[model samples]
Target: MALLTYTPEIAEARDKGHPIVALESTIITHGMPWPQNRDMARQVEADIRAAGAIPATIAVMDGEILIGLSAGQLDRLAQTQDALKLSRADLAIALATGRTGATTVAATMICAQLAGIEVFATGGIGGVHRGAELSFDISADLQELAQTRVTVVAAGAKAILDLPKTLEVLETLGVPVIAYGQDALPAFWSRDSGLKAPLRMDAPAQIAASHRMRARLGLPGGQLVANPIPAADELPSAMLSPLIETALSEAAAQGISAKGVTPFLLRRIFELTDGASLAANIALVRNNARLAAEIARALA
Candidate 1:
């Protein structure tokens, strides 16, 4: 039996050979609460459309991988409770068990490549956690970027992570971390992570050309376009550092580990910042979506 289901919009886009940017669904199901998530999803999709590309928001439902979702489906997904947060390891399990799952960066890239889509957008990619040497708790996203052939656009690795360690791992994996129009890598809610980017590309066309060049050279893995969040929406890293440190400390005290770490940090940060972090998140995601659309068009 076929495992893929393309929403009508995505099917039409595919038929026409139009540029389609893949979006991960975990942002809808796990990133925010209720109506807000739905609204953000809709707005991001609209932003992509306005930028002249199709949006393919990927997820797993009823034993199949959905390349895109209809309006009703997207609404249902945004309201879904207990949806599996699937990555490379568990994506197949969710499909085999006919369970609903929201794809993370790694899983989304896998799905996008399978569907012949070449570019993906997300708020941020998971990476090395703080004190990873002892915990050895690195995210699967790093390994996925090393093997996948899709170009991923994001603000950067979450500010809650060890950005330096994350960059080191990405370098080790041979994943090109290209800062979009900047010299510094972006931290999720912050415009700068206080670290220099390994590569910088100013134009979407240049990024697209690099992606094609990689494939032509028989290189494995994808490119990470670290698109910085807009200045007006960013929370300066100087202000966020203490907040993130406090959240991290709280998580350690509470013994939160693995999958629980990110959500716990985000929630704590939201409370600490009076919901400002969430607003910044929404803005950065929409910004990334717009850029992803441009890159997709360039690739096409």
Candidate 2:
């Protein structure tokens, strides 16, 4: 019922049967600093539009879901320091309590499905965290992809996660994880994770048709189109390993875990790479948006 009160520009696009892509808002509030966060948000939307689709950046604000945010709201959210990062479990609570929050990958998928946006573009999917056996920290995004009827276009799982375990869970859930063009699954910021992709599709048409077929079969979930980062922008998994190790050590030493873990690691990597990670982040997100647009267009 609360989902019904949500309204934003993308709602009009949905009603009109236009191509629309769902975008997550955590990148604005938790991924980076204010000005850059707002800038990146705008650029991702621009990328989606340039690729011939409307972008719906999802968030919860003042007891309502915002399917797409205006520039001013985006700016304010990016600058607000204490905004909650919400996922499926907490999304309803945030909405019922009239709390403003940024939607994470999991929350975004749920909202996108409710809004009737069949395609979502994001930088990467969260997965089984490092040390999962002990920490038991798993991302809800994996389960979200299993039942939310919205195709998500992302580079791949973040490299800091246990990629092997992530793939195993995705497989167990009956989620379709299809690589875009390569035989290997991409590691966010890296073109190849050294693991062969379970499935691969080269064209947007094929991916869209598969989505349609799934619906025809009464399937409950969506597809994970694992688009690789542009070759020119890839950081190479080998090169990122040492840097990631250093960042992970820093995170552990600082007692950072759970949600705090990702942002901490990213910030450390940003400083470690002298901004290369951020640049790669921007590039891959835009690339995913473009690919998601193509899929949306194909769906149309």
- TM-score, every prediction: 0.99, 0.97
Candidate 2 lDDT over residue span 121-149, tens digit each: 99999999988999999999999999989
The candidate maximizing lDDT is 1
lDDT value, candidate 2, whole model: 0.91
lDDT (10s digit) by residue, model 1, range 189-225: 9888999999999999999999999999999999999
- Cα deviation at 88, candidate 2, in Å, is 0.8
